[model samples]
Target: MAIKVLVVDDSALIRNLLGEIINSEADLQLVGAAPDAFVAKQMVKQFQPDVITLDIEMPKVDGLRFLEVLMSARPTPVLMISTLTEAGADATIRSLELGAIDFIPKPKLGVAQGIEEYRSVILEKIRTAARSRVKTQRTKVKATSHLSYSSTEKIIAIGASTGGTEAIKSVMEAMPPNAPATVITQHMPPGYTSTFAKRLNNCSKMKVVEARGGERLLPGNAYLAPGDRHMRIVRSGADYRLELHDSERVSGHRPSVDFMFQSLVKSAGSNVVAALLTGMGKDGAQGLLALKQSGAFTLCQNEESCVVYGMPRAAVQLGAADKVLPLEAIPEAMIQQLEKVKAGSRL
Candidate 1:
């Protein structure tokens, strides 16, 4: 049986283009293409698509409003087709919070030409979305950060891909104001990571900013890797400062989780605590293993809590994670490890 897909966009060009791509894949079937949310709602009820690709800026009923309703009522996997602008990025983040599995960044230029360059990427995201877990988000009372450890020397490194924005928010919001300096790398494009950082900052007690090379890592703050740059933790005398690299892609991502974790292996391995969260590929596996080998306390989100278990599964297969935990359990677990490491250092 082929995976059923529904394309919902106000533009006929996008709908037709996506239809063509879905039809090209033998394992994928295009169930319907709707020009607006009303038509999309009808198609969704009529075809019962396994996956939906929604344009964020749709006419009449917008994608976010429709997504909220669908999640409350139908709860199907959704992937937003978003413009790569700053505004688009902000809306995309909001969509993720509302239960979207992932997003497809629309080409800023010629539709056919720009999309042609990302043909493989577009298809892969669709397939990934099809397999993702879809559930309406539960309202959890925010956990106050109880991180009591005050060592600025300890570094927390986190990486995720698909379903990451929400996961990252979940972890960050629970962190206490006094938590150790943290670095996060979520596989995102350029304009989006900045928006993501801003969003996190609004909810998190710790100050969160996009990493821009040479900034010293400090306790009570978090740094997000720039979307286009590979962020590395480097020893600057006695301190750890962020370094951004415009190097070639590693493990198929520019600001790859693998590169970030592997970089820490040489710089602060023994003092680092890392977590590999829900993602669609094995990008963070080898690097997490390397960090574990270098004496870091490493964690991977358990399959039960993951939207896509590919990345964490790889780490588990490699014997990388010290603890395979649920999303709600990871933040406190990370802080506890920090406390343990701190106590051991004192001894």
Candidate 2:
């Protein structure tokens, strides 16, 4: 049976376009289209859709408000449709925190042109959302006592997708103020990465910023790969700096985890700690394996704690990860592994 999807938007044009795109896919069935949240609530009972494509702005009730209600009540997979502006980016990130599976940016151009341009992305998000597990209750992250460690030469590389926003936040919050240099690649569109990085910065003791080319890596700070760019680590004498460039998408993502991990395997080798977090696809598996083979410490998030286990599952199957840990346990695992590396180096 085809995956059943419902389209919810205040605009008739968007509703029609979404319906058309969904109908065009052989594996997707458009169950219903609602112009507002009021209509959407009724259709949810009537059609019983497998996934919902929600617009952030809607008549009667807003998308975020409705999403909160729906997740609390029914816990269905929801993919948000948002504009590509700064305000849109912030709202979309909030939606993810509210249990949305993912979001796609609405084109800035006219509806018809934008829909046609982003048809593939929209369809793929729907498929991914349909297969995702929706949680009614989000994990509450408690602030733990921070560990105090002097700056070390270790670098931590992390990659995440689907449910990574919260997962990354949990790990970052648990880290000490003097945590080692960190690099991250989360599958997000262009406008949202800066906001995501800022949000992470606010919650964690470490400084977090979106990677701009040529910035030197510093202990106690994390660099997030900017959307639409591939970020690689390069050595500058005895120090490390980032190189961001436009490149073909790897594993279906531009700032791919594989790209960053492979670069680390070449530059940092045994000095790196890499973790593959929750995501929907196998983007980081091969690069993680390469990192492990190069003597870097590698870890993967366990399935039970994952929002979507695709990436970590691939790494585990490929024998890439040295440890498989729950979300709450990964920070300590990384710290322990890094300490082991430090001890071995002294010996």
Candidate 3:
């Protein structure tokens, strides 16, 4: 049987294009295409699609509002169609928080040209969404008491894709004010990381900011690798600073988890705590294994808590993760590992 897909976009061109692309795939079947949320609501009830391709900008009922309703009533897997603008990026991030599996940016040129260019990406995202786990209930994170560890000279490296924004927020919010200097690489496009960092900063006790190269790492602060760049950890004397550079895509992503993890292995070595979270591919598996081999305590989110379980599963299979934890348990696990390292038992 083919995977059922519904395309919801205000633009007839986009809807038709998506419909064609989806139907072109041997494993996919286009169930319906809606011009607005009103039509989409009816189509959703009638077609009961396995996956939905939603446009963020819709006429009457916006995509975000429609998504909230859909997740509440139906809870189907959704992939957002977004423009490559700042406002579009912000809204797209919000959609992810509301349970969208992923997003594809619209081209700056003509719709037909863009659709043709993104043919493979659109098809792949649909397939990925079909297999993804949709979270209907949001996890509420409570503030925690601060840990008293000396965060100086200790570093934490994290990497994720797909469901990473929410996963990163959960872990960051659970961290106390005295947490170690942390660096993160989440697979996102260029215009979105700043917005994502701001969102994380609002929820987290740590000051979360998009990394600017050459800034020294400080405790109680988190540096997010800016999108479209590879962020590396470099040491100068006793201080570790961020180094951001434009690079060819590695493992299909710039600002890749593999790049950051490999950098930590070279610079921070055993003084690091690294976690490879929920993502759709094996981007960070080998790098996490290298960190583990260098004596760093590594963790991967277990299948029960993951949205896709691809990256973490890969890391676990490669003998990289010292602990395979749930999303709610990972922050505490990191703190425990930090305590062990501080106690001179490891690192």
Candidate 4:
């Protein structure tokens, strides 16, 4: 059976164009098209599409708000379509937090020209999203216990991409407010990291913010890699600090997870707990292996809970992860392990 797709956009032209593309592929079938969220909601029930292509801005209700409602009612994989401008990037990031599976930037030219330019990308995103399992957790749950850190210096380092927005949120929400300091690298565009940070802060127990140069890696705080720059761990006296650099993109991502993890291995060494989460690529796997070799406790999100099972799968296959966990269990497990190390230090 062909993968069913629903195209939702405010523009009639875009709705039709996307439908055409989806219907063209033998593997994908265009189940329906809607001009707005109101219509889209009804179509979802009627079409029962395997995937949805959603626009950010629309009449009556915006894409993000509609997505929230849609996921709550009936969880389905969604692929966001946004303009490539700075504003569009910002909205796209917000949509991710709201549960979009992935996104494709619309072109800057005329409607037809724009669609033509991004045709392949849009199709590719839809194809990838269709294969992913849509997981919408209805309840918040934590692991059996929290880790007790005897030393105040323990830190958590994490990396993710693709379906990471929701995945990261799942892990962070399950953690204690007083958990160890955390450093995260999630692939994102410039001007979007702040919004992502804010969203995470709103939903999580710990203080979450984008990393600023020279900021102290404080206990119970989480710092995200700033977009457009590489973030690395640096030691200052007895404390660990974040060093932001305008370096070349590694693995096609600025704020590369591999670069950050490799640096953490050098700066924090065995004192760090490294985690490789769900993503579409192998960027973090090699770095995670190095972290394991350097004596850092490493964990990878298991395939069952992962959006793509790419990065974490690579890490596990490379013998990097000391433990492989479900998405919802990662935070509590990390906290517990950190506490274990801390308790040992005090002994």
Q: Could you estimate the TM-score for every candidate?
A: 0.97, 0.95, 0.96, 0.83
Q: Candidate 4, residues 1-347: lDDT per residue as tens digits?
A: 89999989988888888888777789999878899999999999999988999999898999989999988888889998887676777788777766788887666678888787777767777777877767665234473354545344677888998788777777778777767788999987677778788888988888999988898887768999987789999888877889998889887778899999989888888888988988877889999999899888999989988777888988888999999988767776777677666633321
lDDT of candidate 2 at residue 197, scale 0 to 100: 98
Query: Compared with the true structure, what per-residue lDDT tens digits does model 3 show for residues 1-347?
Result: 89999999988888888888988889999999999999999999999999999999988889999999999999999999998888999999999999998999988788899899989988878887888889876555555556656555889889999888999999999998878899999999889999999999998889999999999888889999998999999888878989998988888889899999999999988989999999988999999999999989999999988888899999999999999988888888888778766732111
What would you estimate as the lDDT of candidate 2?
A: 0.88
| Per-candidate alpha-carbon RMSD to the true structure | 1.9, 2.2, 2.1, 3.6
Steric clash pairs (candidate 2):
none
Worst 10 residues of 1 by lDDT: 338-347
TM-score of 2: 0.95
Pairs in clash, predicted candidate 4 = 147-335, 147-336, 148-339, 150-342
List where candidate 3 sits over 4 angstroms from the true fold.
141-144, 343-347
Where model 2 places Cα greater than 4 Å from the true spot, the runs are: 140-148, 343-347
Per-prediction tally of clashes: 1, 0, 0, 4
lDDT per model, in order?
A: 0.90, 0.88, 0.89, 0.82
Provide the lowest-lDDT 10-residue window in model 2: 338-347
